[model samples]
Target: MDTAISPELATKAERDDLLTLGVEEEYLLVDAVEPRAAEAVDAVFAEVPGELRDGVQHEYYRTQIEVASPPQLELDELAAALLRLRSGVAAAAERAGVRLVAVGTAPATGQNARIVDNERYHRMRQRFGDLSPGQGMCGTHVHVSIPDPETGVRVLNHLRPWLPVLQAATANSPLFGGRDTGYASWRSMMWERWPTVGPTPYLRSHEHYLTLIGDLEASGAMLDAGMLYWYARLSATYPTVEIRMGDVMPTADDAVLLAALARALVGTLLHEVRAGIEAPDVEHPLLMAAHWRAAHDGLEGLNIDMATREPRPAWRLLRQLFDYVRPELERHGDLATVTALMGRLHEHGTGAARQRAMLASGASVGDVVDELARATRGEPGNPPID
Candidate 1:
């Protein structure tokens, strides 16, 4: 017997029929003059209008704020939303006498005066100890809708080896605690302290994924599905696979490029799964090491090649990644934009390299922040110097 779709199911099914995209970006609220982390997030939040209130949010730390975009179809639409959100949040923070800077970690490493006054956040601080308050990092998260949990799991499985490639392209945080951490993404170092924050091994089926989540809940490391903080996971709140790698990019262009790559990767992997392609048999340790290399070296030196599991220059890996997903990009009409962004990233270096270059040339931490601030406002900050 053939089954017919219910009206409700049809309505819900329509949403996942196409690949919709969403973005979540986090920013650090800092003292306008001294560039120290400031506790003015509350005031800044108050300035957001109620109509624009749904997307603007306070994060785990008092000095942090986050904004999310609604589902979008075109890359330009998402880009516009991000720009508006950045400017909106920037205006509010400015009114509060603080500036909104888009780096992964706080420039000053001093302890936060207070965490977000939420029960869950408080519990996280208690559970994680010093790791919670010590972190002031932010990230750019992209959510791409999948037809179902089964497909979502498959997408995550195939995405494992490539997450580090995305991380390297978006590595912007090279400084933390008023000093060079000597790694491109110091925030990632702080983030991995949580027991559940890195990439996960393959889940052969959706049932296996649910079973694993149940086990994690039984172990009490996580309160719920929301706490399943893999680098990429099926979003509990949306019918989407959220790719949560990469630092929060300083400019809207970089953020949109990340989103496009994420969507293309998910779409390509989903098609491969439907075509009966097997997911890569990658070991979990290898994935973790790949992530570590990208975090430590960014894109300037070497990175782990997902195809061969061998060391290669970061740029070569990035090029290989683009080739892997070229078909999907062409399908979505994003190849040109993605290619242009790739060229720009390679030419200018990853965000971490750009930040280091400024600092290396006698630019103070304040100068670095100023340049990042300029980029956040859609102005071309300092270009990559030779």
Candidate 2:
């Protein structure tokens, strides 16, 4: 398995950041009585319109389903596509007597749930047996296309430090397996367990990246380029830097704000690269530390500087990030919407905070589940999508 990325190939790859955007969202397929990842995506797939069928796929578990947005240029277009996809999935679930809940982790499954029997998943289960089943967690994946491979790698490196910021902003899972996990984004914790996951190492050159990939492959740590699973990484299939830290947001507006910020971050980094400005490098350990804080504390904890090794309040850093990307948001015509939504998130708290607040007021897990269902269906009492 001499899977080394060639220097020539890296050099030939474009490094500019183009403004293409794509999104992938994971949903929990729950039985009417038990909220778990349902193994019925194929059945749900049958109900989706042919145009959207291509983007819908089964996840690791039969209980989970994923929908991907087509490559879109405008933010509004992405929002509309996701909405339509959500509606279609919800309709399918209703007809099947199941429900699709949008959260980072499912709350009803016990420890004995069975894994789906598929070649790839079976291989994963055989290799990493216990950890494999936990992969049922849901998330929101944002893809921003970079024109070249080197720039893709560079943008990934530069964007590494901010992954935690995005994760904290979109943190939505405060419960797992029907109990409070006491973490804002339990999905981050669930994912960090896999080998070659989380933030990528800072590679000084394309050759270095090739060396790292080859070494990991040779060690059998990763099966292919797709397994690198960094919090932010260059996608093997698309010329994009994929940000995979965000939890599945409760409302479409949160999704849009997240997408807007992700695009702006990637766009800003590309601008810096073209101008020959050096991007800041944060160490992997520092990134891990920030991620831990994000999962456990959400916006309530202080973020540590990966380079400086000091703590700063997460709220302050978030404000700084919003200010930093304001120009790009404005350019995309999403600034006003992003601003208002972000303000609401800060004022009222993230979905996790709201969920916990509801529970504290004597709502059961069933109550929260009902709330999520209502929210997913765009019911009148739920938060309005932008």
Candidate 3:
């Protein structure tokens, strides 16, 4: 097999066949001088340039903003769109006299952890009560085009076991309230406080998926389909499977790496579904274990491998994912880019590790947030201590 992926290889970028993908990243706004979350989304969103305004929008919280890339077939095009969204939003936030930081949760909490003043969010706050207080979390959601709901459910099944590895790779919330939270991605811990936010169950078909959504709604576990916050799900509004696995990463490069992997995973599984390969039927309990382990250790420690129900180094699991999706990645002209990004991930550690490194070097929480602001804008930060 000519499996090599290089500049000379025939890539999907050079062909017409490719899967379309888009990325949605939520960011925290912090006072440029203070360590706490800043309620500046209104100002920042107003200042976003007209060209990029369509992609930039407010999230559930006034302290956060979200940017979504338009669907694109080529990895290069997707990367360019992400760069424009991140840089443009960063510039807008700065002009609003706030800093844009991409860590999954704010390093310090303030009285300003409030939701956007809208009717929908107001109802959410009333319904969820204290569960809504921790709603300040941010995440990176990747949407890959799918043909139909039936195949999208099958894709979700294949995606479940690998979701932990994705979470581990992008864990970025290590600090909260001016202290190390012990968990690598505190955002994951915060998010799971909601009734519907957890591992996606293996589905029998598209009907099964919809049935569960209706059940959750009737039971008050969720108010609507949009609140079915599984780690992966069929998008309610788009013809795409949304992978809501990772914490918001620190840089556009990190986000693009994840988006490429997600697209390749969906493509590989779509082929497998057509070939009659059974999606791995991992149990829900084990899936939950894997997610918790990943959030606790990020990429620097053991992950529960569903294949054996035993722990393996997270890096090894990530490599196994690359091997499984190598063909699809090469087909999409992303193998080389994925290869290079993995090297960087290995060298720099995850966003969580990098933030922890700054603290180990005696930087204050305010200083850590400053470093995150630089990284969020795609500026390089100091190397990890480990």
* Top TM-score prediction, candidate number: 3
Candidate order by decreasing TM-score = 3, 1, 2
Residues 12-106 of candidate 3: C-alpha lDDT, one tens digit per residue: 42356567788999999988788788889999988999988778888999999998888777777777888888888999999999989888988
Candidate 1 TM-score over all chains jointly: 0.93
Which residue pairs clash in candidate 1? none
Model 2 misplaced regions, further than 4 Å: 1-18, 109-111, 305-308, 382-386
Task: Report clash pairs, candidate 2.
Answer: 14-148, 15-148, 37-63, 38-62, 38-63, 39-62, 39-63, 107-178, 198-231
- Candidate number with greatest lDDT: 3
Against the reference, the lDDT scores of all candidates come to: 0.83, 0.75, 0.86
Which parts of model 1 are misplaced by more than 4 Å?
1-17
- lDDT (10s digit) by residue, model 2, range 324-371: 888877776778878887888787677788778878888777778778
Question: Comparing 1 and 3 by lDDT, which wins?
Answer: 3
Q: TM-scores of the models, in the given order?
A: 0.93, 0.90, 0.94
Off by over 4 Å in 3: 1-15
